[model samples]
Target: MASASTANRWLRPEVYPLFAAVGVAVGICGFQLVRNICINPEVRVSKEGRSAGVLENYAEGEKYAEHGLRKFLRTRAPEIMPSINRFFADPK
Candidate 1:
């Protein structure tokens, strides 16, 4: 059989990437959970007397409301494109 140190050396590098991937996945999941909780739609409806769900109740004479992400993107696209273009431009 191979020596213990030799076996460990072979195993460590293989395991390190797996551990790093798992850590990144866990961090992403945690961030998503917190974001969803913070943007809870129920709280907005209860406090503002408006439907905060994805679909608005336009049939009941309430104004239609776009999703927060869409609204932000639409309003900020002009401002965001310049920054994105600058980041991708040639450094020379």
Candidate 2:
């Protein structure tokens, strides 16, 4: 159909930069999300050691969500940011 063919236009060279920009934005958002979580629990981590820290943050976030998933996700999630940073910044 005409609509399907038009979708293929995104593959053209002119749109490559648009794709790249979106990729970068998504990557940064992902990285920030992980960083915000893993740095909780008052644990200090080095720069390189943080590669897997996001997983820890996710687990901690689960506990924080026990109150109410949808509500807590929007309101209290930021509470962990400072604690996580403190932990992640500590010298091991």
The candidate that wins on lDDT is 2
Q: Tens-digit lDDT track for model 2 on 1-92?
A: 98888988767899999999999999999986786666444343666655545454666656554545567577654665777887888778
TM-scores for all predictions: 0.36, 0.40
Query: Candidate 2 clashing pairs?
Result: 37-57, 39-84, 40-84, 42-87, 43-87, 44-87, 44-90, 45-88
For each candidate, what is the lDDT? 0.63, 0.69
* Superposed Cα deviation of residue 69, candidate 2 (Å): 33
Cα lDDT for residue 43, candidate 1: 35
**Quick one: RMSD of model 1?**
8.9
**CA deviation > 4 Å runs, candidate 1:** 1-11, 42-92
lDDT of 1 by residue, 1-92 (tens): 46988878757877888889989999999987785556644334254445444545355322223556667788764654786787878485
Q: How far is 30's C-alpha from truth in model 2 (Å)?
A: 0.6
Residue-level lDDT for 58 in candidate 1: 53
